[model samples]
Target: MSGTIHSVSERFDFTGDELAPAYRAAVDAIEAGDLVVMPTDTVYGIAADAFKADAVQRLMDAKGRGRDMPPPVLISVVESLDALATDVPDAGRKLCEEFWPGPLTVICHAQSSLMWDLGETQGTVALRVPDHENTRELLSRTGPLAVSAANTSGKPAALDVYEAEEQLGESVAVYLDGDRVSGGQPSTIVDITGETPRVLRVGALSLDQLRAVAPDLTSDDDPAPDPTDAPEPKPTEDAEPTPTDAAEPKPADAAEPKPADAAEPKPADAEPKPAEDAEPTHEVKPTEEPAEASNKGENNKPDPDVRPAD
Candidate 1:
């Protein structure tokens, strides 16, 4: 609420391609720690300084989100990845090198102390460096912005500045109105949290597209076992066949089933007896005496009870 929603959407339009005032106003808004709705190559995103805890919390509350589900950090450029994430697994780092300035979000271990939360962060963070000018400009002035698709939690992402303004104007303080984002889709999200990088949500990028970078990525149920680690399959051999008319009878001295037999025989000396261990340990007894023991009354009143009955 500290800044105004200045009209810069027209400047961001790719058809018109004018972008001077839009960048300036958006930067000003971000510098003041205000939220901004802006265009990216992917979709319209509402952004706030990634490090400003209060502003970030306000963004989450406004969007009806909790700390457990946080927004992603949008950096101005790819080099910013190291600043926000630690231990960028090789697979994720490789993805960043190829997909940054494009529609792809790399999930990695967030710095232990990052104050902002993206939606359902799960002790991790989504990082992106979009291929858009207005977003880049705003990010440069604002530092990293914890942003998400400019739509309500479960709704479609806004594709243009005007639509974003219509949808998020009340929630965000500024809209860095730029060109209508192409693809009109969210970036592909891959979680590199485990031994293998996995596609949590597929988007603009196809599985084949991701494989070009991380050969280890797989949409298959199981990762292909490492060539060096896999045990070789056992060799199959023919077993000796019995003569058609000859059959082996059960051994008279055998006391247990043979490995290939269907039935197991008991020992000859073993006797069958009642299974005493299986007997019921507890018994129920009626406390009342038989009917013959009770005295008859002429009125036939309800039987005199000795003990209270449930």
Candidate 2:
């Protein structure tokens, strides 16, 4: 029961009641700002107190991840969505209603009032309500946890408790073996922070399945309109008319110095060229490969479609 980091992790079988000693040990470890490996809906995850800055940093460090790849928060219930995130759009709510307690991770703008840090979240947080009952039961007591797949950054996600232990080692204080539940596929991820919901990575849920709930949902595969093809034509049509009209008035208003007024602004107009040159430097959303499952377990298989939350 020591809160200090354990040099050797202890594993316990979490079955039967939620109030078991194993659950208590896991809870105590989390509250003490220590890392705990627990079974999530998709994959076993290393969890830390989401509100604790040092604990969260330990999670990132254990996974060999930097601040850029912030771990997703696992909540106990749907109601906790509003408590962590702000401006949950109607589309986001509908998606959550249809797919929560399952494998759909939604990234929304984080609540500004909250003091916790989940790393370079860029004012947003990825949230999910896992479908596992025991996990949810533990979450009800622990509030929210900053969880990521229980493995090193480049390794495959751990499907069972032993796999988690092998990779995480003593960095974790406690391991709650929920014994690998069904649906091993990673959760499908959708980002609802923008005006429309876009699939960052497809996993347990399909793109078609998401669109059924939010018809406007788009995937990374969908081609973004070529910037070169769009505004250029409209500007061409508008610009041609203006010059023709300017020509007609040139004879009568030649003495008005209108051309001088117009030509004087050319340098100011050229200033935007650098901005136009800089626009293409931006890249699209990061694409994640499906997590490869370990061969040590027969039930564990490599998923080809969706990237894991880790």
lDDT of each: 0.66, 0.80
lDDT of 1 at 66: 72
Across 17-98, the per-residue lDDT of candidate 2 in tens digits comes to: 6548888898999998999998887889999999999999999888889889999999999999999998888988999999
- Candidate 1 regions with alpha-carbon error over 4 angstroms: 1-18, 113-120, 220-310
Of candidate 2, the 10-residue stretch with the lowest lDDT total is: 286-295
> Model 2 — TM-score against the truth?
0.70
lDDT of 1 by residue, 1-310 (tens): 2333334433233324465666666667667766777778878877776677777776776565677878888888888888778887888788888988888888888888766645566678888888886567667876888887787666677888777766655656556655566678778888876657798778888888898989989664446877667554432232112222112332243232233333655345544334443222223112132222222211233223321222
Residue-level lDDT for 172 in candidate 2:
93
